[model samples]
Target: MSTSTAPDAKTVRQVRPALRAGRFSTVLRVPALVTIAVMVALLLVLFALDIAIGDFRIPIGRVLDVLGGGGTRAQRFVILDSRLPRALTAVVVGAALGLAGAITQSILHNPLASPDLLGITAGASVGAVAVIVGAGGGAATGTLALVGVPLAALAAGLATALAIYLMAWGKNTAGGSGVMAFRLVLVGIGVNAALMAVVSWLITRASLPDASMAQHWLTGSLNKADWSTLIPAAVGLGVTLLVAAASARTLAALRFGADTTRMLGVKIQTQQGILLATAVMASALATAAVGPLAFVGLAAPQIARRLLRTPGEPVIASALVGAIAVLGADLVSRTMFPIDLPVGVVTAAVGGPFLIYLLVRTNRKATL
Candidate 1:
C-alpha cells in the first residue's frame, strides 16, 4: 500500500503541471486573444469612421479605393495624405502608452505608478520644449532637426527614470533596503513639478510662433500628425511591443515579491531594467509624437486588467485598450464639438472623473 501510494503521489505531481498548463492556455491565453480580436474589430470601425466623416464625408468604399490607389486625386488627398496619418498616430501612440502604463504599474505594484506620475512624461515634455525654445521657437529646420525632438525627448525620459531610481535607492539606518516604492513615487512627484515649471518658463521665453508651436504640442494635438511622426511612431510601437512580450514572464514574476523571484534564480535587476527601459522608450516616443497625452498611461492598464479579469498585467489587452481609447477620443474630439479639441483634453476630461472614482472607491474600501 505504501509503495502504491508513493507512485501515485509522483504521478499527481507530474499531472499537476500539465493541468495548470492546460488551464493557463484555456483560461488566460485564449481570452486575451479574443480580447485582442474584439479590440481590433472595434478599432477598424473607429478608423473607418474617422477617415470617412470629415467635411466631405467620403464613403468607406471610396476610402478603401484611395487606400488601394484607385480613387481620384482629390479623394486620394483627403484619405491618404491627410486623415490616414492622424488616425494611425492615434492608434500607435495609444498602444505605446497602454503598454508603457501596464509595465510600470506591474513593476511598481501600485495602481497609481505610471509614467506621468513617475516624471517620465514631464521629462519628455521638458526636452521637447527646450528644443522648441532653443531653435528660435521650435522650427523644424537645420541639420538633424527632423529627429531631434523625439531623440531629445527619449533621452530626457531615460534620464528622468534613472534619476528617480537613484534617488529612490537608500539604505536604512540598520543597513538594509528601505521602502523603495514609496521613495520612488515621492521623488517622481518632485521631479515632475520642477520639470513642468521649466517647460512653462521655456514657453514664455520663446518667440510668438515658437511659443504657439510649443503650446499646441503641449496640448497634445493629433492635428499636427504627418508621415514623419507616423512612420517613427509605428516603428517604435512595434519594437516596444516585441520587447514587452519578451519580458512578460519576468514582469509577472515581480508580483511574487523580490525575494521569492530572486530565489527562483531570475536576475531581478536586469529584468527590471529591461522592463523599465522599454516603458520609458514607449512613453517617451509616444509623447514626442503626440505631446504628453495624460491619463491614458495611468488608466489603460487598470482598465485592461479589469476587462480581462487577470491577476497579471495584460500587456496586449492594455495596448488594445489604449489604442481604442485614443482612437475613440480622437473621433469625439474632432466630431462632437463646435470646433476640434485636443485629444488630450478629451482623455483628461474622461480620465479625471475616472481617477476620482478610483480614489473614492479605494478610500471607501480601506475604511470598510
Candidate 2:
C-alpha cells in the first residue's frame, strides 16, 4: 500500500460534508430534527414578539410577569386579551394546518395536494361566506366569522372529499392508482372553480356591511381573533390530533400503495375515511378561524418534505414546519406593513407562487 502524507485541513474540511451527511443518514435525519427544533425556538420568539412589540408595549419584563404570576390589571388584560389570544390562535392554526397537510398528502399520496388547490379551503370559504353574508349581520360578525359557518365548512370539506373518493374510486374500479390520482385532481379543479362561483354569488347577495365582513373573512386575517373563537377550534384540533397520532401507521402505509395497505391487512377504506374525516374537521376549524387560508395547507407539507427528505409524509415534522411557516408569516405581516396585514393575505401572497412552482416541478418530475 502506498503511504500518503497527512491530509491537509482543507482536504479534511472538504470531506466533512459527505461524512457528516453519511453520519446524519445513520441518525434520523438532522434537518428534520433541526427544522422542528428551530421552529419551536421561533415560536417562542414570536410569542415574545407578540407580547413586546404591539402598539402598547408592555416591556418583556411585564410580559413575562403577566405570563407567570403577578401583574397589574392593565398588563394582565393586554397579555390575556390581546397578545395571548393572537399568539394562541397562530399556534393552534399552525398546528392544524401542519396536521391537515400531512393527512391530506398522506391519504392522497400526492405531495401537491392541499386544501387550497384541492378546494377544501374553497368549500370552507363557501360555508363561511354563506354565514357572513346570509346569516347574522354586523352585530354578530365577530362570532359568525368564526363559528356560524364552521359547520358549513366542515360539511363542505367532507362532501368534497367524498366526491373525490367516490369519483376516483369509480374510475379505478378495474385497476390503477395513476388514473385515480389524475381524475381526482381533475375533479378537485372543477369543484374549486364551482365553489368560487358560489362564494361570488353570496358576495353579491350580501348587504354592504355583510359583504365587507365577508371580504375581510375571505382575505383570511387573524387580527380580530379572540377567546370566543379559540375554544371551538381548540376542541376540534385537540380531538383530531389524538385520532391522527393513533392512526399514523396506517396512514404511513397508505403512502406506499393501496395494494400494500391491503396486503398488510390495513382496512384501507375505513382508515382512509378516518384520515380524511380528521383532515376535514381540523382543516374546517382552522379555515373558519383564519378565513379559508387556501395556500398554507397546500404549501407547508411540501416544504416540510423537501426540507426533511423523509421516507414518508413525516406527519409530526410537517405539523411543526407548518406552525413555523404560519407564525413566521404572521410575524412578518404584523411588522412589515404600516397597517398589520391579515395573516391569510400574507400566506396567499407567499404561497401562490410556491403553488405555481410546485405545479411546474410536478410536471417536470412526471416527464422525467
Weakest ten-residue segment in model 1 by summed lDDT: 14-23
TM-score of each model, paired residue for residue: 0.89, 0.87
> Which candidate should be chosen as best, given TM-score against the real structure?
1
* Candidate 2 lDDT: 0.77
lDDT of 1 at 228: 82
lDDT of 1: 0.84
Q: Point out where model 2 deviates above 4 Å.
A: 1-31, 139-147, 173-179
Clashing pairs in 2: none
Error of 1 at 229 (Å): 1.1
Give the whole-model CA lDDT for all candidates, comma-separated. 0.84, 0.77
